[model samples]
Target chain A: MNMLRRHWPWLLVLVILLAFPFLFYDWTKGRHSGFVLTLMSEIGVMAIFALSYNMLMGQAGLLSFGHAVLFGLGAYCAAHVVNMVKAGTIWLPTELIPLAGGLGGLFFGYVFGWLVTKQRATAFAMITMGLGELVSAAALMFMAFFGGEGGITIDRVMDTSLVGVRYTSPWQVYCLVLAWAFIAAALMRLQTQTALGKMANATRDNFERAQFVGYDPRMVRLMQFTLSGFFAGIGGGLYVLIYEIVTFDTVSAAKSANALLAVYIGGAGGFFGPILGTIVVVLLQSGVSLLSNAWLLYVGVLFIVMVMYAPGGLIGLIFMHLPIWRAGRMRELLLPYARAFPPALLVLLGFVFMVELASFTTIGAAQGKRFTIGGQLIDTTAPMPWVIAIAALVLGALWLRHEARGFRQRWDELMEGSKRAQATAAPKPQEAVA
Target chain B: MEVFVVSLLNGLVYGMLLFMLASGLTLILSMMGVLNFAHASAYMLGAYFAYTISQYIGFWPALIIAPVLCGLIGAGIEMWGLRRVHQNGHIAELLFTFGLALLIEKGVQMTWGLLPVPYRVPELLDFPLFKIYGTQFPAYRAFMLLISALMFGAIWLGLTRTRIGLVIQAALTHPDMASALGHNVPRIFTLVFAAGTALAGLAGVIGGNYQVTEPAMAFTMGPIVFVVVVFGGLGSLSGCFIASILMGLIQTFAVVFDVSLADLLAKFGFVVTSSTPFAEILTVTLPRIGALLPFLMMVLILVFRPRGLMGTRDT
Candidate 1:
């Protein structure tokens, strides 16, 4: 019963994940939003990738810029292995193809970790960046494995099937991805509870202390890094399985940045941070990018604000509200938040207007397209639009600041009251137990 | 010999430009431990600022005005942005700058369009200064060398001779000690950041004309500048200078040469064809891999030395 209680949350998550496609089956009228499945599958793959990356950045405090090298290599390996299976040379089941990718990731991780883990902090960042660039350059130059920019394509379906389920449909592939993504995420989360995980955190906090405790900090970093690479590779393998194509872009700096953005934005501080981050980022990448050319700008602004104000990310923001919610004082904060919302919306609209005007004036002009959104033309060259944008920005900002100050006062009061109540309420609980 | 001399001159120009950027970076990083990821974005801004200013007032005035504008902007970022993020620790500060770089890149794109600006050399200096082996060396190239040299002299004198320079040097190497000894370290940081950005702007004023000013230029040049800083060693200007020049020469010469590893292998009685194992990587030429050289040097230097060429401490 205790074990069931401890695992109920994970089991619930698993149930939701398993039912997701079926839930979509009704929404999409029996075909399962094949597009949605593809997108969700991509989210799953990126989630695993970001989680593994967090192992190095968050747990080990190693900021690596070239992590995609391992990821890409694993993908390439998986692709080759799939090709082998298709050729009937390997005779391996398609289900276990990710293992080949994981092994490949491990092999390269071991090699890279030897050289990279020796340096700490900033030097490590630079070196990894260089290594990433080096591999990318080589990836383009070398034609055999990387396939020279066009990348390697594979057929995930084969004569061999472990469960006799043909991997012909997007739903089937997605289910494969879901199962692997869940397994990978669960294993990585479990790893954090292990000795190696604790030691990794110890090394991150204080190198000398970990050393004093008889753990070689370098070895700890190396082991953690290698394992992280293994997970990243597994993610890559899934990428190959889902997309059936892996290219230089897989290992490119941009892709690595994607992982970084997800991990950091998700909150590298705790488990499931990457998962939340991956969902938001992938959603933004697929959804927001389709709407505007300035999606990156929005994401960048969000990241900067998070770094400046809330380093704990989205999950961190949720965690911060837990105490207030527990004390049943969450309602006090709602009105203030609602009051602040309009100004925030005004500011966002203003910023968007300015960006759209500027972009329309330049890039849109160059493209010979008018700045029209939903049949309304924005006369970007006119001064009125610019004036309106500036006014909205300035006025909204001032109003938001005033509103925020009011919220802060109320927040402090509620927090203090809760603290006082807890102080008085504490002994009664102990006395009741006695 | 002629190729060697021309390559040397070109290398020196490029290397000096890199040093101007890296010197400021080394000081800020060593002192604050915040690797300002947006440093290259500042350089990009400088070029754009100059480009816009030059259109209205001509290049000469833009040269003086753009850098000052960049300096002031840098000061604002330091005073408000970096200072606020500093309390969160270096990683947050670094990430803030990284985000700033992304935001600025978008801003630049929105303002300037996703195209190269029409920033060019003044026609007065566009004529060839001299010819070596039938190749014309532009007067602007000579002017670049002269300007960089003058800036170098100014910087050298400023750092070694001025009162503010001593405080800056002290603050750079030992921030806490300098702060404890009655110097305002944060102010020094703000000043250093402004000066660094101004130097970057100055480089942009000249470099924009030499290389096209575009949105992508920041990213293209950003990594190379970082490699120079690392290869030169952290907290050492002279080392940065040496590393920059060396990298510049290597890049210039690599471009000039058409030799490949295949030729070398053939000379050693090992013939390579398409069938040979890893033949593509083996046969790729130095010129083909020219872009990878600085990155390669960075990795090798970091792996072996870690402290860099003359760095007294590990970064």
Candidate 2:
């Protein structure tokens, strides 16, 4: 009980992770469906990638638009290692192959970081973008190394294992991935406590002040960037091990954007922000992509919304509610929630209809399909559906605005009451609920 | 010699096309401090719009209407989307633009399908305008050069001769100071963004048929345009012009002069037999790396001269 109380968060996380596969397996009736496991593995890899990105963006204040160079290099190098092992040149454990990727990433980071670290802010971003483009183009040009557009693929069933296991199972791979993810996360956590990490934060907060304090901001940024590259490389190596393919797309600007999206959407300030972001992003990617081809448009819209309304991210929004929730004021806001529900639902339904209408007009029209709505097949060729969708969108938006103002007003009143109650040292059950 | 002249003229045409795209991007980037990743997507949209419009209307009408539509889209994006994101800082704004680019590319694909749209040169401009020895120069290429030159002159005059242009020029160097001086910085940003996107759209209308108007066109042209902008520096139109020309010439001339390291070595009495490990590397020619040269130049320029050719700022 004492241990549980002391490390409750860690215990809770561990329990959830371990219990996930079993719960999913039960839900699917033990069909050997490995979708959740695969998704979790992807989350694990991307979590590391997003964390590494944050190490530069959040800590060093260096906005890198091309961090995928390290990740892709690591993947390519790992692919080569897999090939070498398959060729009987060396025998190594499957789990340790990602270390080769880390080494490859470290090597390139040192070289590229040397040149890139000289510039700051926008210059750094532009230079990194240039380097990224340079490498991706070179990857396509050099067919020997990059394998051109077709990309390079290696079989993971090498039959050589340190533990003498054939390593054929997805569950086995998942275990290895989880172990590495935990180790990487622990190391990253430890890194946050180091002097270099502190200096990185100092540089991010105010470079001029850090320089006045006798620390070179550029050096701090470079070191953080290189280390971030190393971790990203580890993720890349894991990527190859999971998918067994390395392509130019792996290191393209799009991949860098993916990391940026994950980190920003998750929240940059918190340590576990990237992990949360990776989970949300990977889930949305897998789930939404299956449902709609316009997943990217939705993602773009969501990102724009996040950038505008919620700069701190989903996690930040949750954290923002903590103080109010802890004061037992959340109970009082149930009335506002009830009042807000109809308008929110109407807005959501209207928005979904608009998106569907747009998708039907473009993608569905191309496929030569008609949209069915409310027990009637609607002709997508007609402008009536479009008119209705636009009307619904406008009306719903107006209603949502009105409801949102009311919700805000009610929330403010509850919060004021909660603050007053807190000041009087009331024995609030809200803290326990929180 | 004839091939050289043809290549030079071709390079000049391509260079001007690139300048049409890069100049607007450079201006927007320098003025707003936002590297709009969707700039090339706007170009792609322009091409698609022109192609669709030309199919119904005429080419000239399409050219005029498509760029105007692109400018409206740009203005709308800046006012509603980018303005909202600007508060989060540059990185967020950049990411927003990146997402916008992806969405635009996908949206273009969704609307136009995956195939390349057949946007052809007008009948009036389809014939050869001049000949160099046996090589002929198309009237379309000449038209492109003329339009780009006119645009360059107009931009130069607008910046130097007009009050708004002077304020924009000042913003290019000192955006904070311009804002402090009571200029409507936001309005200026929107105007610059709209103008930049219009230029990109114009490039698309001209260059679409010159190249290929495809879904993959944005990806192909986006990086190269970025390379030109970065290599040209942040706020210098002169640098942008020079870099665009340099990139175009390098890409064109490289394709014209197809010589490999192995060929050079062979001229020096060096021979390599078959089944050699280094033979593949030795066989790499400049022409084969045509797509990579501009980016290589960018990296070299960034490393050696961080401020670029005529850039006053570090970017």
Candidate 3:
């Protein structure tokens, strides 16, 4: 009963994942679901990548900018193995290629982590950046392993299977991604409960204190980084399996930045934060980019807002609501929250309108494209549109501030009340897991 | 000999330009413990601002106005944006600047369009200053030298002579002590950040035309400046200067030379072909691989001398 209670969420998640393709089958029929399948596989890949990154940034507190190097290296190694399979040289099943990638990741991680783990904080960040740049540059320069600018491309159809499953369809590739991602995520989660993981956290909290406890802080850091690399490598193997092509972009700073964005915005403090963040970022990348070119700007703005206002990220914000729920006062603040929501949204829309106007006037006009929303064409040269944009921006900002002030007051009151209630009643469980 | 001298001179000029950017960055990094990823954004802003101001009031006046304008923007960012996010710690500050960089990049692109602005050297200084053997060095290069040197002097004098400079020096070296002495450390941070950005702006005004005034100039110059700062060691101006010059010279002189490791190995009668380990990497010439040198140097330094060259404090 205890095991079932504890593990039910995992089972539920597994069921949902298994049902995902079937659920989208009616909507994404024929040639289109290839897109959906690819997108889903990408999510799985990014989730594993981001979760691994969160191990460093969130749990271990080691910020690495060159993490994608491990991922890319893994993919490249797997690509070689794939080619070897095609040539009938190595007799390993297709399912075992990712293990080869994991071994490659571990080897590189052990070598690189030795040098990097000697430093901490800002110095670590710089070293990782330098490392990232070196690898990325090398990936472009060397054609033997990296395959130069065209990157290493290979056929995945080797007719080799471990469990009688053909690896031809995108759906089959996605299932592989899903299985590996789940296994990798579960392993990483299990890592958090280990003594090494505890030591890593200890090192992050206070290096001196961890040392006082007779642990070499450097070794702890090295272990965490190397282990994180192992997971990231598995993610990369999945990447090669899904796309069948891995380029220098996989090892670029931008790719590393994607992990940083996902981890931070998802709430680096939570185990599942990066997982959630990965999904949202991929969704935004696919959905928002199709609609507008300013998707990056929006993501940047959102990231900054999250960093400034909610240091805990989306998960952190959700966690903050726990006290109110436990205190049974969730409904009391709903009305105030609703009142604050529209003005906040209006403020966002106003800024978007202004940004779109500026972007349209400069870039859109140059490209000879008209800015249209809901079939209404926006004339950038017109004074009325400009005035409307400005008014919406400035006025909405002012109104948001007013509503925000009221919201803050109510929020503080409710939070304070919850705290008092908790004090007066039985003491609530302390949040120690993170 | 002429190649050596010319390359050396070119290196010095390039180094000085890098110093203009790195100097401000080193200060912010040392004092705030924030890498200021947006530091390069300030340089780009300076160029764009100079380009706009130059269109209105010509190049000479634009140089002064653009830097001052950048300083104001830096001040605003520090006071409003960074200050608010300070409680969340250094990572938040870094992310804040990263976000600011994105916003400013988009803002610049929106305002100035995607293409490079036609920001040219003034007609007054457009002539060649010196003829090295057969090569003509532009008078604008000399002007860049003069401006950068003056900046170095001004910065030196200001820090040594002025009251605010002493406070900054104390904060740079002993931040906790400075803060405990009731010296309003936050205000000092604001001042340092603004001054650093102003220096970046100045670099942009002079160096922009030398390079090119474009939106992408930030990313190009950004990492190179960071390399200079790191190579020179953290929190040391003298070190920053030496490293900048060294990097500048290396990059320029590297372009002059066309030799590769493979060639050197073959000189010793070892004919390593494409099948040899790291053959592609070894066969790549110095000029082609010059861009990799700084990163290689950075890794080497961090590994052997983590404190950097001539650094007093460990980073």
RMSD of each: 2.2, 3.2, 2.2
Tens-digit lDDT track of model 1 for A1-434: 87786679988987888777776685545577777789888998999999999999999999989999999999999999999989878787778888789888998999999999988888889988999999999899888878998999998878587999778888888888888887898899999999999999999999999999999998998999899989999989989999999999889888888888898899989888989999999999998887777788888998998888888888898887776886898988999999999999999899888877887788778888788768988788889999999999999999999999998899888878877777777554343322
Isolated chain B TM-score per model: 0.98, 0.96, 0.98
| TM-score, structure 3 vs. true | 0.97
Clashing pairs in 1: none
Candidate 1 off by > 4 Å = A18-29, A427-434
- Per-residue lDDT tens digits of candidate 2, residues B1-315? 888888899899999999999998999888888888899998999999999999999899988999999999999999998998888888778877887887888788778876787789999999998878977889999999999999999999999999999999998888889999999989999999999999899999998999999988888898889889888888899999999999899999999788888888899898755576678778888888787788777878888898888887778
Count clashing residue pairs per candidate: 0, 0, 0
List model 2 lDDT by residue over A1-434, tens digit each. 76667558876776677667776674445543588888888888999889989898877888898999999998899899999999999887787888888888888888899889988887788789888988887788788889999888988888776776665766677777787787788788889999999999998888899999999888888888889889989998899888878999999988998898898888898888878888888888998887676778778877777877888888898887776897867777787778778876776666667677777777778777667777698776688876877777788788888988988888787778767877898564653522
Lowest summed lDDT over 10 consecutive residues: which window, candidate 3 chain B?
B306-315
Worst window of 10 by summed lDDT in candidate 3 chain A: A23-32
* Model 2, docking class: medium
In candidate 2, the residue pairs with backbone N, CA or C atoms under 3 Å apart (3 or more residues apart, or in different chains) clash, namely none
Measured with C-alpha atoms, the lDDT of residue B210 in candidate 2 is: 93
- Report how far residue A118 has shifted in candidate 1, in Å: 0.5
